[model samples]
Target: MPGMGFGIRIEGLSKRYGEGDTAVDALKDVNMTVAPGEVVGLIGPSGSGKSTLLKCLGAVIEPTAGKMTVGDEVIFDNGWKITDLRALRRDRIGFVFQAPYLIPFLDVTDNVALLPMLAGRSNGDSRKRAKELLEALDVGHRAQAQPSQLSGGEQQRVAIARALANQPPVILADEPTAPLDSERALAVVRILNDMARQFQTAIIVVTHDEKIIPTFKRIYHIRDGKTYEEAGQALH
Candidate 1:
């Protein structure tokens, strides 16, 4: 749904572990929305519900209660509205983990093309699309290089390209630059902002990295099962 004027919409999203007195509420009636082409940061300290919220939104775990929509698809409502979360995740959402996690044996192009291939696209079309994203992300020159041969930044970029391979409406990036230096971290953030704008993808980045925290226009800080939305100052 690129440039389709649609994005993530969440309401009363909640999650809990266990039950009754032993239950721990990881999320508490959370509500938020992100527009198309927008980028926001999700920040919180250890033991907070940052990961819990991400898991809920990513469809990795079911919420105890809530509603969620990825782009135009209502994936969850009280319970899941869709039977196949894996398909929804693959077709409508994208994800970037703390590490690039690129397959060691695959070259950069194959690492990205793999997702489309899994989705049943032809190898030629998948590789063509992969090359386009690699070029857009400025990693085209290294398309033939194996993951083992790339720098930290290059690996992260490849991971991002893979996430975009499906042209998903939303992308969840969990600590994407945690392993990079200050300069490299900032570079990742800059690239994220640019890519969100270019592709009209809504991006939510979960991170504890202090260096790029203030760069977000808006930040959702979760603590003890609650969330506090705050405005952030831009970096120079």
Candidate 2:
């Protein structure tokens, strides 16, 4: 990976599935850019290729064409510049889904530490990093608690800590507030914004929740495989 700033940029990105006659164009000339410490919303209806775009950004799937740059490094242009997709994802991209998705057998500390551990860090160092993140997220009190013992909000906080463990430049969050009430949902967005600024991380949130939509400073609305950028009201 080349040394670069903290952000992600995508230009003319497109994804296609199947053969010519049976082909489906999932994304068409999609363009997006997120700056470090900024939180943007990615809103789209069902079957609008939101997931496809996420997968491409996450390096879970290869795009058929376009350019993707993480910070100043060109990760994908026509084809991936780096050979190890798994390592690329693990090292550069963080992800938060609708559910907490914590490991059932591990406690909160170990759950967040698992990412660093998988990346070859020593157990002690990984746990140390996890503890710091848990403290930052205000979940340090539950560091020893099992996922089963945690409240929904606590579990989600731990999940956010895990995503920030590596201090990745970009985090892709998909409907992270879906399971929470209005208050908790707004709380999640607040946390995301705070974390982004604190860590200088760029975050793109994919959501359909109307309650938090107005909270974004900028939003990308995807429909029929294209994206339109809009300025948001950005609730404080």
Candidate 3:
């Protein structure tokens, strides 16, 4: 039932650092919208505002100005509307980093299940949902294995599964395929695409990997704190 409204929307978003005498603008009037069940790409070079945009969307940092809406609610309009940012991040926004960042101490199932568990779901229900996500991601056979025992691709898949465990309306993936070869990178993108469609989650993958860049249906290119939108080949 998540993603009931527009998946993610941003308008006139801007972020500034420091005081007026030494202010640095990291984002300038950026606007974007990602619909439910869509997979889009965010591409930019170093110091190009991609990180700032991601942090703002993830609620890790606040923006100087603009609006952000997710699903049916407006999270920010010039300021944060949600008081419980921790719960918002935990329950509504999922993150996938370049590294797997799995809890080395926990098995695959537990790693994926922890999000829902923290969100107040019963352990039994959380683990069941985790197992189902693992099966969907093709990592169900390794449910009992620790992070160290899995390959890079499998670890990424587990990370993806963890991101989706909360059924968040929006997923933010940061350089997810930077560590893989062409084949494995494409495989990861395919899994992300499948997951987006299956769950009706809007996904934005921030990546520099050229191998999978051409696979996006749409792309947002950021440079000098501004973004340009373009269409890409919708490769499966």
Candidate 4:
């Protein structure tokens, strides 16, 4: 099983752009941990270093100094220990953006299966896995539909399935429910919680949407490039 260790861990993580007087500190000694099978919320105002933190965790950018561990592997210590960040991301981390960003030309099934295929799985096995995920997400009916043909909720569900396609230990979701109505937004969170438990995937949802804030069992609030944790209503 993947994610055998703690899902994701960061200690003294900091990111700075530029130098000297012009230097901007986007993150300051940030610390966080997400256990396997847990879903947590990351809430912050604009310019609170939320995006920077996400980039660091996603391996899109490097941190000036930090220690990070994904599952049992320590990927960063002062600097990156892994040479192939792209492959690390592909095999270990799943991302769900605000938009579905599904391929326009590919049908829903292909869109979800693409990740596993890129990871070198056989095409047949990849499509089979995608179909199973679609069925789990209740979007199997739309497997043959194009992205443009699905409703906003359907597209997001497909996106979630794609993110889980690799069975990555962790999932990073950025404003995933921002475009949906309150009803749909909560439904999406419910689905995330279910997926997290089912796959033992640690999920961090970054959002400012007040509609679903109270649903999390724990919330991390970031401000002035720092983070603080608080208990949530745990509505789910």
Q: For residues 145-236, write the lDDT of model 2, one tens digit per residue.
A: 99999988888889999989888889999999999999989999999999998998899999999999999999999998899999998896
Q: Write the per-residue lDDT of candidate 1 for residues 1-236, one digit (tens) a residue.
A: 23555589889988989989999988999887777787888888988999889989988899999889887878899999999888888877889999999999889999999889988999999999999999999999999999999999999999999999999889999999999999999999998888888888899999999999989887888888787888888563
Worst 10 residues of 4 by lDDT: 1-10
Question: Model 2, poorest ten-residue lDDT window?
Answer: 1-10
Global lDDT of each candidate:
0.89, 0.92, 0.95, 0.95
Clashes (candidate 3): 0
The deviation in Å at residue 86 for candidate 4 is: 0.9
For model 4, residues 1-236, the per-residue Cα lDDT tens digits are: 12356889999999999999999999999999898889999999999999999999999999999999999899999999999999889889999999988899999999999999999999999999999999999999999999999999999999999999999999999999999999999999999999999999999999999999999988999998999999888786
Q: Name the lDDT value of residue 32 in candidate 2.
A: 95
Task: Assess the local accuracy of residue 128 in candidate 3 as a C-alpha lDDT between 0 and 100.
Answer: 99
TM-score of 2: 0.97
Q: What's the distance in Å from true for residue 202, model 3?
A: 0.4
TM-score of each predicted structure versus truth? 0.95, 0.97, 0.97, 0.97
Q: Provide the RMSD of all predictions against the true structure, rounded to 1 decimal.
A: 2.0, 2.6, 1.9, 1.9
Candidate 4 global TM-score: 0.97
Better of 1 and 2 by lDDT: 2
- On TM-score, who's better, 1 or 2? 2
